[model samples]
Target chain A: MPMNAQKSVLGTLGSRAWITTVWAVTIFFVINLLALIATVMTSSFGTRWLGTWLPAGWTVNWYASAWEEFQLGDLLTTTFEVVFAVVFLAGLIGIPAAYALARREFTGKRIVMLLFLLPLLVPPVTYGIPLATVLYKTGLGGTMSGVILANLVPALPFVILVMVPFVEQIDPRVEDAARVFGANTFRLFVHVLLPLLLPGALAALLLVLVRTIAMFELTFLTAGPDSQTLVVALYYAVFAAGVRAIQSIDAMAVVYMLTTLVWLLVALRFVNPTQMVTRAKRP
Target chain B: MSDTARNHHLPLKMRLSAAGFDGVTLLVLPAILLLVGFFVYPFFYGLWLSFHPKDGSVFGNYKTFFSDPFLYETISKTLWLSIPVTILNMATAVPIALRVRLMKNQRLLTTILVLPITLGTVLVAEGMLNYLGPQGWFNRTLITFGLISAPLKLVHNYTGVFLSLVITGFPFTFLLVLSYLTGIDPTLEKAAATLGAGPISRFRHILLPLLVPGLAVTFCLGFVQAFSVFPSAVLLGAPSGPTRVITIAAYEAAFEQYDYSLASAIAMIMGVVLLAIIGAVLAARSLFYRGPAGGGKG
Candidate 1:
C-alpha cells in the first residue's frame, strides 16, 4: 500500500529502481550478519567443520573444554560481581545527579554535564592508562574493585544521561505537593520519586551491565587474573600466547555474546536502543 | 531575634525545601568527586606523564615517536584507513537506513543490525578470524562452487581488519542515520509530490538538502569511532603493515616496551587528530545548519 502511494507520488522508474536497490542491499546485509553468526555458532558445536558444507561430526565437548580451559565459571561469577557492583554504584550516585540536573538550574551546569560526558566521549583506552596508573599507585589496581571503578567512569555518566530525561518527564508539582504535606527531602524521594524513577533506573543499569560486560579495553587494562570479565577472558583465550582449539574459542565467543545479548534484550524492553546512538552523540 | 526570626526561618525552609544549590550540591557532589578522582585526574596525569619520559628528558617521547619511521607513519596510516571506512560506512548506511525506516518490522531489523555491536569489537574480530580465514566457510563455499581454485587470504591482513571495522561500525552509523531520517517531516515530501515533482527531484531537492547536515554529523562521529580501531586492528590486521594504526602503537608502547611516557605521547597525538577532525566537521556543519527545522531533536 505504501509502495503504491509512493509509486504514484514518484511516477518514475528510476525512483522505483532506487527503492528496490535499497531493499535488496538491506536484505543482503542482514543475510551476511546471520551467516556470520551462524558460522560461528556452528563451529562452536562442530567436531570437524573443515572446509565443507557441514561438519562431519558434532559434540558438546568444545563447550565443556572451553569451560575448563577458560575457567569461564569463575570468570562469569567475576563478571556478574563486577557488573552488579558497577550498576548499583552507578545508580546510587547517578540518579541524584540526574535529578539535580533535571530539576534545578545551577551555575556551570553545562560544564558539569560536559565533565560527566568526558568519559563517554573519549575512547576508554585514552584514559585507561593513567586511570590504571593511579589505581595502581593507590593500591586499588588488579582487583575487582579497580575494574568496577574503571567501568564506573562511563556507567555513572550513562546512568545520569539516561535518568535526566526520565526525571524531566515527571512534574515538579508532585514534589512540591509532598513538601507541603509535611514530607522531608528523604521521605519525598522515597515515597514520591523512587517509584517514578524505577523504570529509567532499571533501564540505565541494565545498559550499564551490558556495556561493562562487553567492555574490553577498560577491563583488560584494569582487571587482574582473578578479576577478569568474560570479554577480557575471551580476548586472552583468542590472542594470548597459547595454543587453544578454535572451536573452544568460538564456544567462549558464543558464551560472551549470549551474556551480552541477554542484557541487551532486557534493556531493549525498557529503552529504545536507537535512542542510545543519538544520545551518545548529543551528550 | 525570637518570634519574627523563627517565623522567617520556617518560611524559608518551607519555600525552598531541598530545591536550591545546597540540595543540588548534596545530590551532585558524589558524581563530581568520582569524575575528578577518576576521569579528570587521570587525563592530567597522562598529560604529565607524557612530558616526563623514562629517560628524564622533557619531550623525549614525542621526539622518539616523531624520529621513528614506524611510529610516525601511523599518523598517515590511521587516517588512510579511517577516512575510507567512515565514508564507505555512511555511503552504505544512508540508503539502507532509509529503506529500513519504511519497513514494517523496523524494530526487529534494527535489533538484528545492532546484534554485532553488543557482541563488542573483540568477539567480532575473533569471529572474523574464523569465518574469513582460509579453509573457512567463505573459502570452502567458493571452492565447492568452482568459483576459485585457491583459497583467498582474507584474515590476518589489512582486508580482514577493514571488514571487521565495517561490520561493527556500519550498524552504528546506520542507526544514527535512521533516527535522523525519521525525524524529517514527511509532509515536505508529500508537498513536493503534490506539486508534480518526481521522486528523484523530491529526494534531491527535499531530502538531500535537509540530510546533508545530519550526514555531516554522522560522518564525524563515525570517523572518530573508526579511528579508535583497537581490538580489531590488533586481532585482525597485519600488525606491522598498512593497518598499523596509532592505538596499537600506543598499546605496545605502554605495555610491551613499558614506556609510559611514549604511550601517553602517542595517545595525546591520537586525541589531537580526533579533536581536529571533529572540530573541522562541526565548523563545516554550521555553514549548512538550517536551524530548528533542519536539525532534528538536537
Candidate 2:
C-alpha cells in the first residue's frame, strides 16, 4: 500500500507539472495576442509613438482625423440604416417560419434545411461575386438597397436557424391554448408566441445585426460609394492606394472594433459565446 | 345559409388555423423565395458565368485560368498558406484548449480570446499593419530587450499574413476543440486510469481517438476560413507574390480586369479545393471512429 501510494503521488506531481506548463504557455500566448491588439489601440491615440515601451504622448487628434477623412458620420448612419432594415426584415419573415417549422410537419423538410445550411457552410466570397453580378445586372448594385439585399442572404437564413431551436423549446400547449381561446394565427403569433420567443428573437437578431455589420465579402462586393459599411470602409482606408497616417487608420480600425465589440457584448450578455456555439451546431 | 352550413365553416376555419401544408407554406415561402433569389440563384449564376465567356466557348475561361501561370500560381499558393496556418492553429489550440477546459477562469479566458473574431478580419489586418509594421511595437520591443539588432520585415509579406491568420484563427480553433473536449465523458479517462493507464497511455488510448475527429473538423473549418483570404492579403500581404492567394486572384479578375468568366472559373477552383479538403477530413473522421462521435450524448 505504501509503494502504491508513492507511485500515485509521483503521478500526480507529473500531472501537475504538465498542467502548470500548459497553463503558463496559454497565458503567455493570450497575453501576446492581446498585447498586439493593445498596441494598436494605444497607438491610435498616440500623437507620435516611437521606439519605447509606451507612447511618449497621447492625443485625440487621430480620432478626429479618422472621422473627417473617413466620412464616418455618413458611413455610420448608412450602417445603422442597413443593420436596422436587415434585423427587422429578417425577424419579420423568419420568426413565423420558425414557428411553422417547429409546430407543423411538412414534406421536403430536410431539403429546406439543407438550403438554409448552404449559405452558412459555404464561404461568402464563393457566392458573393455572382450575387453581386446579378445585382449589377438588375441595376440594384451600387445602392443601399443592394447592400441590404445582399446582406439579407445570410441574415434571414441565420435568423431562421437560430429561431427554430428557440421555437422548438417553447411548450406548444401554451400556443394551442391560445388557439383554443379563438385567437387567430396572426393573433397567437403576436399576443402569446411573440412574448415567449422575445428573448430568443432578441438574441438572434442582435447576432444578425452583428453579422451583417461585419459581413465583409458580400458587402464589399455589393457596396457602392454611398453604401460602404464601417468594415469595408476600413479596408478601403488601408488599401485604397494612397498614403495616410498609420495612426489615423488605426483609429478607424478601433472604431470598427468598438462598434462590433459593443454589439457582441450585448449579444454575449443575452446568450453567452459557448451557448451561441452550441446553438449554431445544434442542427 | 342554414345553421348547419355555419357550423361546418367553423371546423374548416379551425383546420386552416392549425396550419397544414398551405398555412406552413405561406409562412415559409417568403424565406424560401429570398434564399432562392439571392443565395441559390447567384451560385448557379456564378457557375454558369464560369462556363460562358464573351468568345462563347464553355471551356474558354477554365482554359485561360489554367494557361496563365500567374493566375494558376494562386491555387498552390492558397493551399500552402492555409495548410500551414491550419496546422499551426490546431497545434497551438490543442494544448491551450486542454488546459483551458480544466481551468476555473475558462469563461473569462474564452471571452478575451474571442474578442478578435468580433473585430472582423479587415480591422485585424489594419491593426496588423500598425502592430507588425517595421517600426511597430513588436519589433521595437524585441530590439529594446536586446533580442534583435534589426527590425524584422513582418508586414506586406507572407510572414505578416501568416501571423494575422494565426491571431484570428487560434481562437476559433480553440473554441471548437474546447467544445468538443467537454463532450468527452471524463469517466472514460478515469476508467482507463483504473486499469493502470498512466496519463500518457490514457490520453493515447482514450482521448486521442476522440480528439482526432474533432481536430480534423477544426482543421477543415480553420482551413476554409483561412483559405478565403482576401482583405488581409490585400492589406497586410504583398498581394502579388508569396501571399497573392486564389481569392485575391478571383477578385482582381472579376473586379479589376472585368473578366467575369475567368473570375468564376477561379472561384470554382477555390470551391473545389475547399470541398475536397472538407470531404477528406470527414472521410478520415469515419475511419477513426466507428460509433457516433459525441452525438451530444457524452
Candidate 3:
C-alpha cells in the first residue's frame, strides 16, 4: 500500500490499457485499408484461400470489360453534367442570396434558410413519392432536368452554408467604400467581393460536386435509364448483377473511389475544410 | 457646373433601378419558390392525403393508419430502433471525432469516411450485403476463429440492418461532431488540467458543458436521420420482424400498391414525429449555447 508500490501497479495497468486501445484502433483502420486493397487486388487476382483471404490470379480483363460493356463513358459524362449543373447553378444562385442574407438585414431569413434545407431534413422516403408525382405530372420525371432539380435539395443548402462564412469574412466597408465612390453594388460584387471569395466558391463547388455525384436515393427515384450515375450503376452491378451481368464491381469501385478521392484532394487545394465549417463564428 | 449637368443628364429611372428593389425576392427566389412548391406544398398535400384516401371516392387514410393495429406497429417499431441507433451512433461517433480531431491530416481520414456518404444507401446496402450476408467475411471469420461452429445467420435480420446503419451513418455524425469539436479552443482543457484536475474531472467539468450544444445538435441530426432511413430497411432490416421501418412500408403503399393517399398519411406521421423531436433538441441547444451570437453554427 506504499505510494510507490501503488503507483507502479497503476502505471503497469495504465500502459497495458493504453496499448490495447491503440492496437484496437489501429486494427480498426487497418481493416478499412485492407478492404480497399483487397478490392483492387481481387479484380485480377481471382479467388484464393477460402475465397475469404484474397484473390488467386491476376488479370486486367475486368477493367477492359467494364469500360467496353458498361458504357462507362456515357455514364460518367451524364453524371458529370448533372453534378456540375447542380453545383454551378446552385452556387450561381445561392452565393449572392447567401451574401444578401449575411450582409443586409432581411425579413424571415431563418425561415427562408430553413426552407432551403427542408429537403435535407425531411424524410426522403415521404417527399420522394410526392415529388415523383409532381415530376410525372409535369413530364419531368426520369429526365436530366428532373435529376438536376432533385439533386438541388442537397447542393443549394451546401452552397448557401458555405457562402455565409465567406460573406461574413469579407468586410462590408469595402463594398460601402465602392458605393461612396459612386461604384454601384453590381460593380462592388464583381470587382471587390467576387475575386476574394473564389476559394470558398471553389470549395463549395467541390463539395456540391461530391454530393451531386454520390446522390443516390433521389436519383434512383428520379433518374431515367439515361441519368443513372456511377453510384447507381455500381449498386446494380454488385448486388443485382455480378460479373456475368456486368462483370466484377472491383474495377468500378476502384474507379468510383478514386474519382471521389481525387476530387476531395483537389477541393482541399482551394478551401480548408476546417476553416469552411468554422469560419462563421471566428469573425 | 459639369457635375450638375451630368446629374441632370442622367435618367432618374436608371438611377432608381440601381437601388435594387428586392435581393431576397430576386436572388433566393428560385430555391425559395422550389421549397414552397415542392416542400411546403407536399406537407399540406400529405396532411390532406392523410385525412382523405386517393380512391375515386375520397376516404380517410389517416383514420385507417391510426386505427389499424397491423399498420400502427411500424410507428412503435421505428421509435424503438431509431432511439437506440441514435444513441449508438453518437456513442461510436463522438469518440471517433475526438480521436480523429487530435490527429493531423484529419481531412484525409474524413474524406475516407465521407466516401461512403457519396456511395448512398444503395451502395451502402450492397456493401452491407457483401460484408454481412450469409457467406460474408464477418461470419466466415467467426467460423475461422472458432467463435462459432458454422457461419451464423447475420443477414436478413436486425443485426445486419443495425450494423449497416451504423457504418453508413457514422461518417455523417462524425463530420458534424468533428466540426463542432474543432471550434472549441483546446486551451480550456489545458487550463483545467493545470488546476490539478484529473482527466475525468476535466472532461466532466470543463469539456462536457462546452460540448453540450454541439452534442445536442448532432444528437438530433442523428435521431431524425436514423429514424427516417429507407434503403437499409428494404435491403437488410428484418423483413417481417421488428425492423421494418415506417418509410419502407410507406414506399410500398405509395409505389407498389399505388396507394398515394396512404403513403402520404404515413409520410405525414413520420414528418410530424421528426419535427417534434428536432424542435425539442433545438430547444435544448438554444438553452445551453446561448452566447452573444448563440454561436449556434447551424
Per-residue CA lDDT of model 3 for B74-108, tens digit only, reads: 88888887888788878777766767778887766
Order of models, best DockQ first: 1, 2, 3
Tens-digit per-residue lDDT, A178-243, candidate 3: 889998867877888879887778777787776667666677777878988887777667645444
Give the residue spans of candidate 3 off by over 4 A.
A1-26, A33-37, A40-52, A67-69, A180-187, A237-239, A242-250, A271-283, B1-25, B55-59, B67-70, B104-108, B134-136, B238-242, B280-298
Model 2 misses residue A82 by how many Å? 1.2
* Best-first order by TM-score: 1, 2, 3
Highest lDDT: give the candidate number: 1
How close to the true structure is residue A178 of candidate 1, measured as C-alpha lDDT? 99
Which residue pairs show backbone clashes in model 2? none
What DockQ does candidate 1 score?
0.58
Q: Which TM-score values does chain B get in all models?
A: 0.89, 0.89, 0.84
lDDT of 2 by residue, B98-213 (tens): 77777776778888877777777887787677677777777888888999999999999999889889888888888888888888878778778999887788878888898887
TM-score of each: 0.92, 0.91, 0.85
- lDDT, candidate 2, at A7: 93
What DockQ results for candidate 3? 0.32
Best by TM-score: 1
Of models 1 and 2, which has the larger DockQ?
1
Question: What TM value does chain A in model 2 reach?
Answer: 0.93
